[model samples]
Target chain A: MRVLGIDPGLTRCGLGVVDGALGRRLSFVTAGAVRTSSDWELSERLLGIERGVQSWLDEYCPDAVAVERVFAQHNVSTVMGTAQASAVAITCAARGGLPVASYTPSEVKAAVTGSGRAEKQQVQAMVARLLALEAAPKPADAADAAALAMCHIWRGGAQDRIARAQQEFHRKAGTARRARGV
Target chain B: MRVLGIDPGLTRCGLGVVDGALGRRLSFVTAGAVRTSSDWELSERLLGIERGVQSWLDEYCPDAVAVERVFAQHNVSTVMGTAQASAVAITCAARGGLPVASYTPSEVKAAVTGSGRAEKQQVQAMVARLLALEAAPKPADAADAAALAMCHIWRGGAQDRIARAQQEFHRKAGTARRARGV
Candidate 1:
């Protein structure tokens, strides 16, 4: 299973794609941002991000997508921007036909560094070590996205177990039905 | 000034455009939603919304944009979707070159119905009366968008005051600079 992880932002969204079944097999598919002039209208900027996300979705065709979740903030402006980033990511995932999962900052940190309160540098260093990369992902946000993808893989495996259990239950039930009929 | 209000959503985004200036005539211009099939990919649906928003922005050239602020939610999935909506609205405003303003749900309701605890129907009723419409805007989300826009106009006037003050300050400084001749 291919998993795509995204760190969404209005100005920049960092994305990482990885092979879900094989641990530590990650390729830095893309890392950059979609920027618009300050003078440009909001719609134009949104469209730019949409286009960029579409391109990625089309190219990657990942089985699943993961994103960062936002918490409440006191600054109205900051909260608003963060909310927008979350929306853009969701929209992209929805469009890509990929099931979307969101991981909170703490959860992502814990998954990557074994501690929810791990510092950014610590998380970055651990992410590099886990993925066996040349260097830590820059801008923090990108690294966080990559880590989120890893968390999803871990979580996703649990989901698979649940699915398998359900299937087994159904199979037994079907056998019981045939036995009763006989 | 014409203002467009957006209630961003992953499945459906409610949009309303109003034509009028503060303390003057106000009229509804257009209101509707950009919707996509849930069965389709999430990213593709986002692209549809982006295209729709871009067309609206290009056609209307709204002076400002207003969106609902995200409130805390107990349901993680709902919260995630709400964040995505907020981000899409903000990005739309940024791309359109329109000043973006956000209002809490209470603020929008209070502005429309004179009570923060007013129900959705009450707020919609008040909006219809305020805009002198024969009927409430269809789909509660659309009415909510309109209410958000109304609140922005009510509060955004404060921004105008700030702008005027800054312009006056610059004018005074320029005059002083001329006198100094240094």
Candidate 2:
């Protein structure tokens, strides 16, 4: 499955797409940052982000979108902007009828580096290693976004598989009951 | 000028339109809440808000939009939703090229009730009095939305006039200087 991960911020929104399925080799598709001007008004900046996310979705066309869930407790000043940006990204994906998922920063770090308290550099290095890239994705935002996508593939993908398996099992059981006229 | 006010929330986004200008008799255009189902997904709820705000803008055709500025410092549990909803509303207005303004909750309360620390009922009471309505706008969110529009008409409206005046003064001064051949 192809997943697009978003590390949302007003000043710089990270967009990354990774292609993989559960227990499959992951490959990098694309990674970039949509940077908005600091001097622009709040609405204009948000509009820029909205358009940027739209363009990213148009170009990459990922199966699902994963965003980093924002918390109000941390980063008192930037949390609002981050929340706003994430809203734009998630809303855009949803408008396109794609499933949207969000993982906390710790959840992403733990998934990527096996440590919720992993350092940024450690996560970056692991991302590079996981994707078999010569270098970590440039700019921390893009790397974080890539990590989010990977996390979703590992966690959400497993859930998807389990759900499909349950449906198949139920279908088989129903067929067996019909054959026995029960 | 006609102004649309939004008290943005994920579950129930308030939308209100008020007609008036600086120092003019403010009248209510319309007020309502865009209620979304809690059972809906986050992105689905946001999409519902987007469509609701768009329909309001389409029908009301307001000259500008006023939204309550969300702060991360307050309502930790609900602030994220508020911020996301505000972003959706502000972005919708911006996309339509309508001027968007935000006022803090205190600003709205103070502008409507003469005190920033005024109670909700007090603000609601003053909103009814200011609009000359027989009753306050039903649903606290809608009432708050109206108050936001009133606040913009009082404060942002003045700033807008000053800006227009400055531009007019500049134009006249330029003409005078040209005519004087200085």
Candidate 3:
């Protein structure tokens, strides 16, 4: 599956697209941040991001979008900004009808580095190793986005299996009930 | 000056823009929400919000953007989402280079109503009366945003005066030092 991972921000949104199947090598399609002009108003900046995301979607045409789950911090002002950034990401994904999955920082780190408590540098190193890139992704946010996509791919297959089993069980139960005509 | 107040959210961002000077009249702006689809990834949703805010900024071009400062909540997930929303607004403001101000919910309510402990409806009513709006702004988020902007205007003006006084004091001290030549 082709996955688009995102690190949401108000001024800059880091995006990484990875394409692969389960237990296979994943390829990076594109990754970068969309930055808004300082002179533009909030609305304009938002629109800039919108257009940027649209272009990315058009280019990648990915099957799913992965985003980092929000994490709370001590700074009130910072928290407010992070919330808005998340809204922007959610709206964009919905508009495209792309299935969106969220990965917590800990989960992403664990998937990439095999440890939830892995430091930033460790996570970056692991991402570099997994992707076999010459160096780690620039701007930690981008690396985090890539890691989220990787985590989703690894865990998504298991989730799909569980969902399928549940569906089959429910279908069989319904069939049994219909047969009894009770 | 025209000031725009923002109540940033993951699903919705309530905005209210008003004339800041003179009688503090309510302008043509009102509160509106931008919603993202649940299916989309969080990153896509955040990018959508960035576009929305950018649109708001471009449309209004408010002299300043005022946002409500949020504290940590009991729910880790909810609080984290709120923080991301806040980040969207702050980053957008910074990108626009507009003076961004923030106020606590209590401060906003106190400014709109006489008491900080006022209920949502109470604060809305006072905001309508204080700004001379024909009716209260629809949705509590909108009212809160307007209240936040109003608080900033009041508080910002006071802060400016205080800053001027401090500058004057410093200037006097410098003059005295030069006269003494010590």
Candidate 4:
């Protein structure tokens, strides 16, 4: 399945699309960053991000969307802005009626470089090699988006299936216990 | 001028609208909350918020929209979700082509109760008195939203004017410096 990955930020948001599935070779479709001027008002900046993500969704038509999950940071304002941008991405995907998934930073690194603690350069290098690119995508953020897309393609579907299976097993167990009149 | 204030949250988003200008007695137009089910997916919850805020904007056509600025919280996920919700409110205002403002919690309290550290009940009671309401709006969140609206009505215009003046001053100063070749 094709997947679109977004590294959400207020000033610079990265968008990448990859076509692949589990146990299959992945190919890069497109990747780039959407930037907004800091001089603009917060509302305008958010609108710009919304429009950018919507355009990518319309152009790529990926089967699923993956977003970088916001985590706690020392700077409250930065974290807040990232979370806001991430939310816009999620909302846009839902508006398009596409499934959405989120992966943590370490998860993306691990999936791409086989090390959760991998450095940025290592992840970028591996992403380039996996996609057979002439060079790593520029601005690092775009490469990070590529890694996120690959991570989702490699692991997201399997994880969802496992979660669903676990839910089903629990439901059957509960029903069986009810039949025994615990 | 009419002002609409939003208290952004995942489950319970508060909305309040007031009509008046600086130095005029403000009157309550409406106050309520937009709620989303916890059982819903994150995307669905966000879409519900977007639709709810959009409807309010369409109905009220407020001169300005005010959102409660999100702050750091002990719970990372909760704070992230709140920031996301606030972004949706801002995006809606921008989409409607309305100017948007944000007020911190302390600023709202101080504007309503004359104390930055005022208690929730104090702010609520003062909001009721300011707007001549029969009683404080219910769900506390709604009352807080009312306070935010009043705060914007009282302070936002002056702040915008000051910002514009500063910008003009800098522009003139830069031109004079260029003339002086310094």
Candidate 5:
């Protein structure tokens, strides 16, 4: 299955396309960063990110989309932007009816490097080795996206099933609540 | 001029439309909340929000959009969702070519109640009084939205001009940076 991974940020959003499934050799399709001007309003910058992600989705048509999950524990100033940018990508993917998953940085590193606490260079080297690339994708964000895509392919099966089950359960409960007119 | 105000939240996004420009008799167009099921995934909830906001924008056709500026200092568990939801609305507004402005709770309260520390009930009362409504809009979220729209109308002139000026400056700077091929 083909997967698109995103390392979301307001100023620089990374996109990586990988074609593979569990137990299959992964092939790199493309990797790059979508950069937006920090000078722009948050709304405008978000619009730019939306357009960039849309263009990638249209071009790659990946079977699933993976985004880096953001936490509130990071730098106070940048965490909000990271969350906002991640939201744009996630919502856009949902709008297109694609299944989406999010992975923490350590999850991606662990999936690709076999160590949760792997260093950045170690993850990069492993990603390059796994995809048979001469070197890891330039732009650290792109490499991070590649790692996320690989993680989804390796660990996403169980994660996606759990995610869907939770969504389905919530939907049913919501319907029941609405039917009771609450 | 008409303004569409949004109080962004994942579970409930408040929307209010008001008619009037600065120094004019303000009229209420509508006030309501767009509720989403908490059971859905973040992306799904966000997509729901996007659709709800889009429907309001299509029906209202406001000259500008006003949204609450979210801060990361609030409840840790919900602040990220708030930021994400706010991004969806702001991005949707920008995509539709609507000018969008964000005001903090204090700014809205100060604009409507003459005090930033005014109680929520006081702000609601002022909104009802300013709009000549029989009572404050039901559901506190909707009232907050109306107050936001009214705030935009009463204090939006200078704010909008400054926002536009900043955007223009950013656009120009961005162009110069690109021209320099940096």
Candidate 6:
């Protein structure tokens, strides 16, 4: 399965696409960033991001999309902008009929470097080695996006299956209880 | 001029439209809420909001759009969701080529009730009286939206003119300074 991962931001949004499935070797397809000027109006910046990401989705046509989940930051404006960007990505993916998943920064690090506390350099290095690239992707945001894509390829499918199974189990259990009328 | 006001939320987004220009008596156009199910996926919920807001823009074609600016909340998820919805509203307005403005809750209250610390009932009562309606709009969200539209009608035009004048002044000053070879 192919997956597209996005590190959503207002000024700089990173995107990476990977081709792979569970228990299979992953290959990098593309990695890049969409940048918007701070001088522009907020709506203009958002529209720029929307157009850029939409173009990427149209080009890559990934089976699924993964985005960095935004959490609280010390700066309220920064966090709000990040969340807004993240939402745009999610909406775009849904519009394209692609399943969307979100991973925290630590989750991406853990999946790529086997340590949730891994440093940025460690995560970048591992992403390079895992993808068999001679060098890490330039710019931390690009490398982070590549790592996120890799993490989703490695973890998302299995996690989704497990969740489906759990849901089915619960549904069956409820039906059985209702049949027994207890 | 007509203004569309949005009270952004994940589950229930309130939208209000009003017809008026600065220094003119305002008249109510419409007020309603866009709701999404919590049972839906995050992307689905966001998509619903996007479609709903976009349809409103298409139908109303307001001169400008106003959204309630979100503030930090004790619940991270709730705040993030709100910010996301706000972004969607802004995006729709921008896509429609309508200038967008945001106001804080206190600002809306102050504009409608003459007090930033006014209670919800006071704001609703004031909005009903100002709109010449027999009853306040149903649901606090709808009333808040109407109040926000009224606020923008009363405040946004003057604010925009002042901002434009300031920009023009700075531009002229820069040109004069450049002519002096400074």
User: lDDT by residue for model 1 over A1-182, one digit each (tens)?
Assistant: 77777876666666776665544455545444445444755456566766776787788787888887766643444554555665676776775557888788888888878899999899889878877787767766677777877877777656766889999999999999999995
For every model in order, the fraction of real contacts preserved is: 0.58, 0.84, 0.49, 0.75, 0.72, 0.74
Instruction: Please report the interface RMSD of model 3 to 1 decimal.
Output: 6.0
Write one digit per residue (lDDT tens) for candidate 2, span A76-173.
Answer: 89999999999988889998999999999999999999999999999999999999999888788999999999999999999899999999999999
Expressed as tens digits, the lDDT of each residue in B1-182 for candidate 6 is 79999999999999998998778898999888899999999899999999999998889888999899888764776898898998888888887888998899999999999999999899999989999998888777888988889999889978877898999999999999999998
Off by over 4 Å in 4: A74-77, A160-182, B73-77, B159-182
Q: How many backbone clashes are present in model 4?
A: 0
For model 1, the stretches where C-alpha displacement exceeds 4 angstroms are: A1-4, A8-14, A17-83, A90-131, A134-141, A147-182, B36-45, B73-77, B180-182
lDDT of 5 by residue, A8-80 (tens): 9999999999998776789999999999999998888999999999999999999999999999989989999
lDDT to native, each model:
0.73, 0.93, 0.74, 0.90, 0.92, 0.89
For residue A106, model 2's alpha carbon misses the true position, in angstroms, by 1.9
Better of 2 and 3 by lDDT: 2
Deviation from native of the Cα of residue A90 in model 6, angstroms: 0.6
Q: Considering every candidate listed, which one attains the maximal TM-score? A: 2
Q: What is the TM-score of each candidate against the true structure?
A: 0.65, 0.96, 0.63, 0.87, 0.88, 0.88
* Candidate 5 ranges with C-alpha deviation above 4 Å: A158-182, B159-182
lDDT tens digits, residues B1-182, model 4? 88999999999999999987777799999999999998998889999999999999999999999999888864776887799899988998998889999989999999999999998888988999999987999888888888899999899967877898999999999999999998
Candidate 3, A69-89: lDDT as tens digits:
765653555544455565566
Q: Between candidates 1 and 3, which one is better according to lDDT?
A: 3
How big is the positional error of residue A104 in model 2, measured in Å on the Cα after superposition?
Answer: 1.3
After TM-score superposition, what is the CA distance of residue B143 in candidate 1 from its true location, in Å? Answer: 1.5
lDDT of 4 by residue, A1-182 (tens): 89999999999999988998778888999899989998998999999999999999999899999999888764776888898998888998988899888899999999999999999889989989999998888768888888899999889977867889999999999999999997
lDDT score, candidate 2, position A115: 98
